[model samples]
Target chain A: MTADFDAIVVGSGMSGGWAAKELAERGLKTLVIERGRHIEHGTDYTDFKAPWELPNLDAVPEREQVHYGGRVIAASTAHFRIKEDDHPYSVAEGKPFRWFRGYHLGGRSLMWARQSYRMSEMDFEANKKDGHGNDWPIRYADLAPWYDHVERFAGISGQAEGLPQLPDGQFQPPMELNCVEEIFRDRLHETFPTRRLTIGRCAHLTAPTAEQQALGRGPCQSRSLCSRGCSYGAYFSSLSATLPAARKTGNLTIVTDEIGHSVVYDVATGKASGVRVVDAITREHRVYTGRIIFLCASAIGSAHIMLNSRSERFPTGIANSSDMLGRNLMDHVSGLGAGGYMPGYTDQYYKGRRPNGFYIPRFRNVTEDADFVRGYGFQGGASRGDWRRGGGQAGIGAALKQDLRKPGGWSVWLAGFGEMLPNPDNRVTLHPTKVDKWGIPLLHIDCAYGKNDLKMARQANRDAVEMLQAAGFQGVNERKAEPDEPGRAIHEMGTVGMGRDPGTSVLNGFNQAHDVPNLFVTDGACMASTACQNPSLTYMAISARAAHYAAEFLKEGKI
Target chain B: MSISRYSGFSRRQLLSGGARIAGGIAVGGGLAACADSAGQEASDGLAARLDTLTTRDALRRPGHFFSIAQFRLLERISDLIMPETDTPGALAAGVPQLIDRMMVTWALPETRSDWLAGLAAIDARARREHGVAFARLEPDTQFDVLSRHDGEALSASDRAYRQMKSTIVEAYYCSEPGATEELRYDPVPGPYRGCVPFDEIGRTWAT
Candidate 1:
């Protein structure tokens, strides 16, 4: 029987968009399903609004904020943020997971921090070397070309530093480091030769290519109001970049407001022949069939769907012969760093809000071995505090206004993003009883930081403080306050990880399920190890590479 | 005076011009004109862009939450706190009016009550200090009384006082005149000029 589409992608988000774009471009008729409301590219964005233009001082009302679990939602980007009341998921009693999600067409890509970095050879071999988690089926050599491919399409701006731990990528001209940042970089390098600071390698177009320009994307305007979705398409987002590219192929079909409930496993075929979806609004159920299925939903999201996909043949879930489908969840150990006031640079200031910051690559275990096996990197910037400083401080007259006029002293802060060792205990499972508005099972996220993760946090904080202090930064304070729980970094991954052995992991080297050849997971769910760098760029590369392999496999009639 | 709303710069201009428009603003220093152009656009236009969002009509209407007597005290206190310098002051920027409207629309009932109690305490203090209400006191006397109250409240870390003062400052600075005339207001800064001399870009960025 002929399927409805050649390939069915279960999401329209970060990796799903890439999957759809690559699959469609390679002459595959693809279906992209989104659970959120439809959002037009440029029209829906609020980037043009000034502070004065926004209502209620650009703050969500306390009454409405409570609906969002008391999370402060900026009025400008509030549309992108999901209301907790509408999309409720259960968290384990003691394990508080701040599952910050944006359930829109573009998903978190619209609000992503855009700091793009490639996972080096060290990151891939980390799991095997440490034996914390399952060894990755593929390594840096396998993904380097794909990273270059995606970086060319999605413009990454950065100054290439020849570091083994954090590999550089195909980059446009890097955003300049400010005077204070330059001083900090120079002093810190002089003090500690191993630790090097370079401008953040972000997926923002500093120089728009003919390909990007042809897609109506332009160069970065450095507005720094990117959380409110860029109308300029200066930043790489699914809505701005991939979805449009997929649409241009004319082989892609998108169905919004159709939430993926589960993958329908055909007992006879031993493959995921179709996806079962529940209508977000109508509460109606439907199934869309395809030759192959790509679960590009978020890590937890895809795992939730797979775990809910119970069948008689595979009682646990589809493609769960290994029973490793919903295990080994991970997120970056974050909220550790330091900040200090820079004494000089009173005569100098920076113009325009640079959306990017400088990155200090992982020095621990590479340049200097720490107590922990894995490592972390620092993402920070230097800037003078704006007039908002007057809100908390003393004085309220002309003197206060005058003091606030020229901006305050330049202060530098470094926030650490460390690799979280994947533990089977840190897993996502469906609640036995609870269900969401669409009658889909609620995701029970039971995740917490391990001993090594906490140790890394403390070490990261100490390293940050020492780096700042050694650079002659006055009033340097260690940022010891860790995140209340995991997922604060919003870098949740590794629910259905790739491994060399099928018994240990779900996906194989090509991100295809070992149990079900036609089923692929190229999102964060397929990540074997939680790399120190941001994972979106890796996800993009993986999705593109997986789609290429899947296409080749289809042509060979391997399935 | 009503807090003027800016518009007119289409999403098309923002998207199509991209870095070029931002580059022009960085080099030319015509951000004030760009910010003012937003105010020049029809206020109704904003309503069409965003769903269920209307610009705060603080100065366009009478006091929403505050009583007339209490409003007079707020107006006096806010002006004293952020008096007219080269830039517009709190009163001119409609800060008191904005606070009053926020009290009714934005603030929770507890917040409204706290602000009311804080306003009453200020009046009571004025009456105790000088045999008159705060609004009735002489300009210099009112300044002295408010200054003392400001110092005590700030040092004590009084939540209501801090919130009120912050609102006043925020409302004034976010105003078109305050943002454009008082501080630099760049809507679109093209390429980031990371290090520029303080004299080159004199005023602080009105973000």
Candidate 2:
């Protein structure tokens, strides 16, 4: 018996959106399933709720904070960090990973940092160049066309500087850096030849093209609150952009609150027969059959789905011939940098809100020689504290009230993203005894920092402090940098990685599973190497590439 | 005829319960307006004043958890924490309401009771220094009485007071008037003008 839909994509995040759009646009009856509730663009955001307007004024109770401190990684921290009551995850003690996240149709892509930069040939060629975990199946050249496709649609706003490291993409007008940032950028250019500082190329609408405007998107109103999910549809999100495009195809079917338990694989045909889903609310069971399946349920999420899918065909997990189902887990080592008060720029101020900041692309380990294996990039900005800061000062009464009417002092901070090499030891496994409210086994993650990661973390802090001090910023404090725990950066990657060799890797260059031809893993799980910059752009690129190839393969009857 | 005379109930309640129940009354009487446009000074000031009057007794009458003396002392201390300015003060943010909410939600029975006892002892110190109860003192006397308790870092009452002060300030600043007017709240920024001279624009943009 044939399936109802031509293909079924298990998530609606960055990868799932890409899969759905590509499949439907190619005239495939695609069903994009999301386990979370549907969130509409510009309306579902809690950011519109003012401070006093918050249910409990956004305060994380002391007891709750201590209890759920570890789970507040990239899980649901876009608005306020997720309270224990919201999206709760499990982790073994002595080995805790704060899986900060939220469950919605668009997923974390709605509240991503919006830093859009392409990973260069160096990044793709790194594992091959230095005998790392495994060679990336596809090179930069192979993935370049897909990147172009994603950018042309996503509408990245940035200046097209001919830098080998940060490739220029389809562009709109870039947001201007403030007076201090201009001075710093100008000064930094003169000081360092190889190091380039540019305005953050973000997935925000500097000016909406007809393509974006047709999607009911408007120009960037310059609200700095993109993290709370932009209500204006001025930013790129599955909710705001891609899903709508898929809906227009009239061939998309979406099912929310149905958690993908496993893909029913037939060993004789060596193909996925259908899939089972557990209802998030009622715990009811349902089966969905499709011609092909795409796993887009985040990095660890997709892996958990894969590991949980145990059939007699493959006991370890589906497509786990190499035993690489839940290994090589990676997330950027964040929380390493410096924040300081700028001495001057008191007279300088800007109008409107720029949701983006200045990006200092990878310098240390990229161009120049480094002690560590990989690289790190600095996402820094020059900004003065706003009126909201008036509450923190010791001042009260009229003087306090008057100052509140005005602005606060000038300040700048550099938060660096450092890349960590994948290790099998740092892995997430299913809990043997414990299960969640949904009866799914708890994800017991055991990840710790390596020597190389610790070194890179220190260097991230060191370079930031040194540069700020060089700019004559007094009272510049270097926050002690350490990769304290896993999942802090929220740039979760690896598990089902891309590799050239079949024995060493699960998926090939096309992100199609070696064990199962029709199955594709194109989310953060497919990342071969974790780069220093934000991973959304890379995810978009890989996803776009996989979806197109999968469509072609479907036509060819490659499975 | 007295309605429900056997049950000793009022006639108005009987009539209201019988019929004539009304629908479609204007909702959001004031809070909605405050949330919408905080820039409107008069409406915001009135809302804040109403907030204070409604919850003002939170500091007075003995808290469900606090002793009578302790409750009275806390009321005196909270007012001094945010003395009135040109605009409404911390108490105007309905901080006492926040305190009572916290007591029910976060605090335990014994810890709240111990703090209440400590508050009474602290008030005893204030009373020994002055003639009347702590809440009855003038603004100057209130400050003098509170200053001694401010930095008693070792004392649990002092810790509780600091937490109370922080919550009050946070509530005030984040209030419609405090955040929007005083702090100049801007959720979404307009346009990003990179590297403009101060003369170009006279004011700062809220992040």
Candidate 3:
């Protein structure tokens, strides 16, 4: 029997959106399932709200504070964030994993911190060199073209520093670095020759091409209210870019409010047939059949679905022949950094609130070797304290008001994001008894930073302090705040990772399941190693590449 | 920045006003509600003028968390904390009303009582120092009494006092007249200028 559709892409987020766009563009009829309410771009965004127009100073009300678990969510974008009480998950008693999520039509794409970076050849070889996780089946050479393809369509704004560890991509005009950043960059080069500071490579349009402009995307306004959602279509989100492009292809059918429960295995055919979905609101189950299935439902989400896809042939889960379906969970080691106060430059101020920050690319384990296996990169900027700083200091009347008129002393902060080794112990499994309201098994996540990860974090903290102090910054204090939890970086990846051998991994070089030929896991789940760079750009490239091969495979009748 | 942008709130909403604090219903043109209610011209400071209007609103509007006397004391405190400078201060910016609205809808029960106790403490200090309530004291005397209280409370690191002061400062700055007039706020800054002289912008950004 013919399939209901040529292809089905699960989870309309960063990777799924790209898969949908590529599949639909290749003339394959694609169905995109989103597990949240449909959001109309621009209409749904609260970017137009002025300071005076914001309710209760954009603070989440005290009554509803219980839902957020002490995290201060801005009231303007509170709708994007799911209530923790409603969407339940289990973590190990000692270990804590902060699954910061947005379950809307565009998923976390709508609220992602748009920092985009590409993993280098060195990153692809790290696992193999150190014998951490399985070696990536494919390398930087295989993904370079796909990176160019996605970057052209998605519009990454960055400066090319010609560094090998951090490869440069097709980019628009890079956002300018402020005076202090420029000074710091020059000073750092003088002090530490290997270290380099450049503007953050973000998935935001600095110069919109005719293709992007035609799809209603424009240049960024630099308003710095991205968390609230950008109405201008300046920042690339699935809703703003891919879904629209997919729709324009006339081969895309998207259904919101349908959660992907599991992959339906056809035991007779020995290939995956379709996906089983649960209606989020109605709690009704339905099967959507297609010739091919692409699982782009994030790292943990895709793992959850794969772990639950139980069948007679694969009782552990569908495509779990290797028993490596839900293991080697990884997230970037975060919450280790330093900040300092800059004494001078009170006269220098920036006009717009630049959404992007300065990026100090990874120097350790590249130009200089570290005691640990891998290294980290620092992301931060310098700016004067605004009126909010007045609240903490000793001040009162007209004099306080007068002092607040001009911005206060310039202070800089450097937040380190260290690479995490793929440990088999840090994994996600289905809860034995506990299930969510939808009767779907809850994900019991047990993830923590390994010894090397902790060592790298401490070294990163020292590097930040040294850099700041070297740049003549005073009051150089290291950050020691609590809740330095894993997964707090929101760069979770691995589980169902790609490898050369079928016994060791779930997916192959093409991001296609080794056991199930017609099934593809192209999201963060396909990552063999967690490179220090933000994983979204690599995920986009991988998704697009996988979709390309999947389309070719269908045309060639390989499956 | 204009009051004309504040059309979401009706005349009744301007009086029965706690909904806008937490409901997030202010779509467009809803900033005028606060300015619309500030018509009573009185001598002394902006507090004395706001006292007449807020007392009436608090008495009639059931949404108001603070009582008439408590509301009046809050108005006096906020006004003194941020008096009418070159730009509109706390009273004209409706900081007291916003705080009262927050107490009803946004504050926890403990937080609300803590604010009430703080306001009562200020009044008691005024009565102990002088011979009248905080609101009844002369403008100069009110400033003296509040300044001493502010210094002591801030030095002691009083949570309630700090919360109230910060809220007032934030509210005033976020107000239309305060934000656009007192500080710079470009909603759609076309391009980023990395470095410019402070005099070029003249004021801090009130984002």
Candidate 4:
């Protein structure tokens, strides 16, 4: 059958945006499908709105906030997030998961904390060495150039730290560490020779180049209101970067509010012919045929779509010949750290609201073998208390006013992101009877942290406390690690993971489904293992690499 | 200015202009530009002025959740926690109005009930000590009653008092005049000066 477009990229977010950009720039007519409302870049951003200008001082309505776990929702970017009631996913019995989702033109890219870091060679070899998950088909050497490609285009602001666990990337000048952070870094390095603390590598343009300036991006103004969306295009997001680049190619056609239902398979060709989509608002069904398809619809979202794509040739699911399609779900085991005050730096201060913090790269399994195989890294900042501290402090009237006018004592905190071993038991499946408002089957996520993850979390907490104490911090408060529920870190991965063998994984080296040559899943769903570093950057790099491969294969008529 | 009607053109222009000035400083002198950038001065002044104006306008809205008498009491309580000194206090910054609006729109029913109960407890204390409603009491008497409750609230798990006090503090600090003038509000500080003399910038950052 004749295809509607050359390529169809589902979910216009971090990965999908890159896929669309690469394909469209390669002169392929690309159709980008987003299952949410359209949101324009600069015009839609509310980052400039001050607290005084916000409705109810930037608090979400009670009923709405409660539905999303009663957490503090900043008023500036509340519009970007989805209310829990609107899109419901079930949790398996006794398993609690917090699925933070942002469904809009840019998906979670609009709301993602723009921490960008590359996974090291150690990460690629971890699963194989540890014998936990399937070994990745590709290695760091294969992805190095691709990481450089994405990093240069994205304008990552970070220092070139020579660390094997967390590789240095092509970066703009890194943001400066605050006084307390500098002190902690120096002292910690002296105290623990193995651990290294550097300023976090983030996707903010410290000094934008002419190319970035031409794209209407400017240097970050240090407002630290990035989640509200940067009007200056200082940070990397689909809206600020890839989608616009794709649009400029004139080969990109975006259809918002079009939910991808399933991938249509051709029995004769044994390739995915196209995708079936349901109108999010109109409930109308439409099938758009494409020569190639890329499922970048997030980890769980893509898994759900693939699991529901039952076919005559592959009755279980398309590209699920191994039955490993919706298994081995993983998120970074988090919520363990420590915080305390630093004294005697009252004379030193800092200017500018730094959007990024310091990153302590994983030292657990690097130099010395711990009880656990994998490791964790710490991400935190040091800052002085403002007037909000007055709430708990004892004072009122003139005295209280006088005290608050001056900055309070400086404090440092560290939160760990630990690697979770991929277990097939931690899986996602479609609910048999239940369906969403769009009539798509509901996703039932059943994932939990394993013994290794819990042990790592405990060590991370202890290390955090010890590090702070060793750095001459006082009144250290050790935060106990919480019971690991999946999806808290929002770095969910490993479903439909790429592996060397087709039997153990759904995708191969280039994020291509082993069963369907024309099909690609380049989002977090293609991760073979959950590396401690932020996964979005890896997702972008993989997506860009996969798109290039897919485009070349199309030219060679390989599929 | 009404947020819905705010064009945000002037602010954006001002910020971009400031950014250019900062950029010029960076080009003129590499690391030394951090010490003296006129761009920082321009942006800081503009942000402060805008914050003051916005906060002044926001404070004028009528209470939505609390009754007229209850709102009056809340205004007094808020002022006592953050009274006017060199800068605008909680009441002047429209913190009471923010709290009232939050109650109607954002606060849970239990939170709202706690606020009402806290107000009543204050009134009861005022009547017991000086035989008058909390709002009707003398300024010193009001302070004394609040001070006693503050101690009790800290020691005991006084949910009502804790809720009311925390809300007042949050609303005040988050307000424009309170955040900008009372503390240090730098909407755009350009490149972060990691370690600087505290004398250079005295107050804590109001992000």
Candidate 5:
């Protein structure tokens, strides 16, 4: 029972927004389904409020605090609450995956770490170059145009210094580094020939272009409290950027809370008829029919749907001939780094909010000092110690209060994001007995890395500590991060990867399932390899490219 | 899952008011008894809910239950941390509420014991050292007390208590209100002027 619409896109997060915008802009009738509730773009940003304005005095319950705090004095901004009682996924006993996710219409885009970076030729060619899991079906040249397309509309604030491994994008004026960071950058570069540090290329609007102003977005307020959702439309989230553009095209129909349960596969035609979804709130099951389907419900989420789509022709799962539907999961192994007091900057401070920090982009086993097959990058910063700097001391009374008024010493902190090589052993499967609230089988994730991930993590941490000590910061030390587990970084990717060889992989160059031409998976599930950089930007570009291609293909009757 | 919708607040508010202060509301009459019975009642309308408090807050009930005068003392303490300078300060940012909620969780049994012990011992130390209770001591004496032996290694519980107090105070003032008001918070400052002269903007950034 094929429906009338030209295409259907599931999930409205990073990729979904791109799909919707691209399809609708091309005048295709597109139905966008979001598992979470709808969010009115400009209207709902709680971060813009004062502390007194929030309920519970901005306090998370004591019981809830210990579980959520990231151990850096509780900076796990409150949105990490995905009700454990309502939606439960099964894990092996003693294995805890702290999936810091918010299931909203915009998904993680609502709470994205908006450090936008394009995965260069080195990243795409890495798999084939090293004889790894699978070669990416597409390359940097194929995606460069789309990256430019997305970045231009998204308004990435950065300075382009045309390096091959780290390609430049359409960028706005970059945010400046503080005095301490500037000095650190110069010193580090002078000390080491290969090492280079630059201001983190972020999504916050430094200077909103005329294109942005036309979208009703104003310049960034620089309050730097962007994690709570940007009220100024300053950062690029689907709610703030893409969806709004899609809505203007007059061909986009959005249906929220319609969680895509499984795709309806037509064995005869080798095409997806539509999808079966259940109301995330009402528990009412419904079916949506469209000529083509684009699954963008995140990495693990899309895998769950694909694995659940059982048909007579494909019992293992829809398009699961390769038996690689839920394998090779990868998230950036993160939180291993160190920092210390920079004694000299006691008298200085900066003004306004610099939402981002210095990003020490991938300087790992790349060329000369080759330790591993893959690489990693560092996104960190230096700042003057604020009032909370008096921690680990006993102070009270008027005297204590008075001393607190003075700013403390300056300090530098560097946190690294290391690459986790894709391995078939690191996989997610369906838990037999457990079922979530919506009767969906719970995802049993059994993922772990090999020597490659470990070597990278250890090196990344040591380098940070050595760098700090070398920079003359006292008490320079390495943070022994909690053990690695899936969903920790929430940047889950590569469950059903894209590859040139359809004989070994599921999706193709255009993110279309090889077995089913009309079925497209444009989410993190389509990633062939998880590059060290944040994957959301790549997902957006790829989704837009695929959606635009799919619409054109449909118009040309290619499928 | 979608029952909750985010209330619209601005970056301006976030920069001006510190986040993460605990608050409890005796809504729907169920918690009315808990409210009145749990807290300490002073002559002033303000109340210090010690029974439920979990840690040693730097800014003690000076008061939190509902004593208007004691609450005023808290307001004054907050203001002192965040002086009017060019912008407003802690008092303008609702830091009293932030402290109140922090105290609720921070005043755990292990931590509270240290607080009661510390206060009693401090006064005793004052009496033994100089023959006067700490509260009655001169402002100079109090400053000396706070500064003395600040570098000493504290017991585990004592360290936790110290951490709580510093966190409460630091969090309150360092927040949007503490930084933006007491100093300055320009959320929508169109272009970032990297090396602006001090005289141009005047106040320093709190963060």
Candidate 6:
């Protein structure tokens, strides 16, 4: 059967945006489906609003506050996040999993922290050496060019630290570390020669290039209001960068508020023929056919769609010949760190509200052996305390006001992101009876951190306190406990991972489905292992690389 | 540092009104519709009808969850916590209104009850000490009652007092006068300077 479009990308987020742009620019009639409402670029953003201007002073409404205890929904970007009750997902008994999601046109790209870091050769080879998860078919060298390509377009601001485990990427001028941070960095490095702390590699244009400027994007003003959506297009987001490029190609069509239900497979062709979508507002079911399909609808979303896609040949699900489709779920073990005061930096203060922070690249298990197999990295910053500190103090009235007018003592804290080993037991499946408001079967996520993850977290916390104490910091405090639940990091990956063997993986080296050609899953779902660094940058590179390959294959009539 | 980026209420314009004490809607440009008819009883009738009783309602009304007497006490206590010095303080910044709105819209019902109970406890102390309500008591007496309550709250780890105080402090600082005049506010702070002398920028940043 002739498809309605040349290609269909079921998402418009971090990876979907790249796929749409690459496919559309290559002259394919691409249709992008978003489960959330459409948002115009500059017009939709409320980034210019001050604290007083925001509703309830940017607090969540009381009725909805219970659902937003995670601090994901602020009044500024409440529209971007999903209500927990409205979109329900169950977890396995005795296992707690938090599925933090933003399901709008740009998905999480609009509300992401924008921390961009490249996974190194060690990350790709980790699974092969350790036997924790399936071996990655591709290496850092394969995706390095794509990382360079995406970094150039995304305008990643980063300092080039010559670290092997954490590879340096093509970057704009890096945002500078503050006075206390600089001191901490020097002292820490001097004490421990193996460890390095550099400025965070973030997707904010410190200096916009001519191409970025032509796209109506400007340099970051350092407003530190990025989660509210940057009207200046200073930070990388689907609405800011990729979607505009895709629109410019004149081969893109967007259908928002359409939840992807399942992939329709043709028995004769043995390929996915179309996708069934349920209208989010009207509850109407519709099918949109395409020659090729890209499932960049997040890690779990894509897995759910694939798992629900039942067929006569593949009775379990479409392209699930190996039964490894919803297996090997992983998210970075996070929320373990230390904080302390840097006493001497009282005289020094910073100017702008720099969005990016200092990054302590993974040191453990890279140079020296750890109690755990994998390592963790720290993302942290140093800043002088503000007026809020006065709340704890015993003063009030004129004297209190005078004291608060002067900035309080300098404090520093580091948040660790540790790698989680991929276990098939930590899986996502369709709930038998329970369904969401849209009638889609609720996904039952059953994921928990293993012993290695806990050990790594503990070590990371201990190391953070040790580093702070070594740097002459006072009153060092460490969170000895690990994250109570999985998915708190929001870096979920490895459900439909890319690997060498079709029997054990869903996607191949190029992010093409092993069982079904002309089908790609190039988001976090394609990751074989959850690297200690942020995964969005890696997802961007993989999506771009896959789209390029898919386009070439289409031109050559390979499918 | 560019304060002009935050458009709506300027420090001078707010000060000129001399503590009219309108809620959240009085500050930003977007809420001009509500701010225009803020003081008029006739306009307030329409505003009241439109009020959804959400967290945002506190922006439009003097109180949401609190009764008239409770709200008056809240305003007085907030002012005492942060009195107007050279700059605008809690009362001028509409901290009580923020609390009233937050209690209804932001707080859980249990949290709201706890806050009310805490307020009643302070009033009880005032009545025992000076034979009047906390708001009607003399300034020094009110301060003494609050000081004792504050000490008890700190020692006992009272969640209600902490919540009320934090809300008041946050609301005060985020207000125009408190942000721009008392502390330094830079809406667009381009090119961060890592190390600047304390004398270069005297006040703390209002972010």
- On TM-score, the candidate that comes out on top is 3
Q: Residue by residue across A437-474, what tens digits does model 2's lDDT show?
A: 77777676777767788888898888888777776666
Q: Each model's fnat?
A: 0.74, 0.49, 0.79, 0.84, 0.22, 0.69
**Residue-pair clash count for candidate 1:** 3
lDDT by residue (tens digit), candidate 4, A314-399: 77778999999889999999888999999887888888888999999999989756998899999999988777777777778889
Q: Write the per-residue lDDT of candidate 3 for residues A192-233, one digit (tens) a residue.
A: 998999999999899999999999999999898888888889
Candidate 3 segments exceeding 4 Å error: A481-483, B1-61
lDDT string, candidate 6, B1-207, tens digits:
212222233334433432234534332232323222222333234324432211222333322345445556777778888888777777767677567555544665555666666676777777777776676778887887887788778668777687677777888888777788789999998887778988899889999
State which candidate, 1 or 2, has the greater DockQ: 1
**TM-score for candidate 6 (chain B):** 0.69
For each candidate, give its TM-score against the true structure: 0.92, 0.84, 0.93, 0.91, 0.84, 0.92
CA lDDT, every prediction?
0.83, 0.71, 0.85, 0.83, 0.70, 0.83
Model 2 alpha-carbon drift over 4 Å, by segment? A60-93, A386-395, A403-406, B1-86, B91-133, B143-161, B194-207
Candidate 4 residue B207 Cα shift, in angstroms, is 1.6
Task: Count clashes in each candidate, considering only residues at least 3 apart in sequence or on different chains.
Answer: 3, 18, 7, 0, 28, 1
| Pairwise TM-score winner, candidates 1 and 4 | 1
Candidate scoring better on TM-score of 4 and 5: 4
Interface Cα RMSD in Å, per prediction: 2.9, 4.7, 1.6, 3.7, 5.0, 1.4
Candidate 2 or 3, higher DockQ?
3
Candidate number that wins on DockQ, 1 or 4: 1
Q: Which candidate ranks first by lDDT, i.e. highest?
A: 3
- Give TM-scores of the second chain, every candidate: 0.69, 0.52, 0.72, 0.67, 0.44, 0.69
Once fitted onto the true fold, the runs of candidate 6 whose alpha carbons sit more than 4 angstroms away are A69-72, B1-65, B104-108
Chain A TM-score values, per prediction: 0.99, 0.94, 0.99, 0.99, 0.95, 0.98
Which prediction has more favorable lDDT, 3 or 4?
3
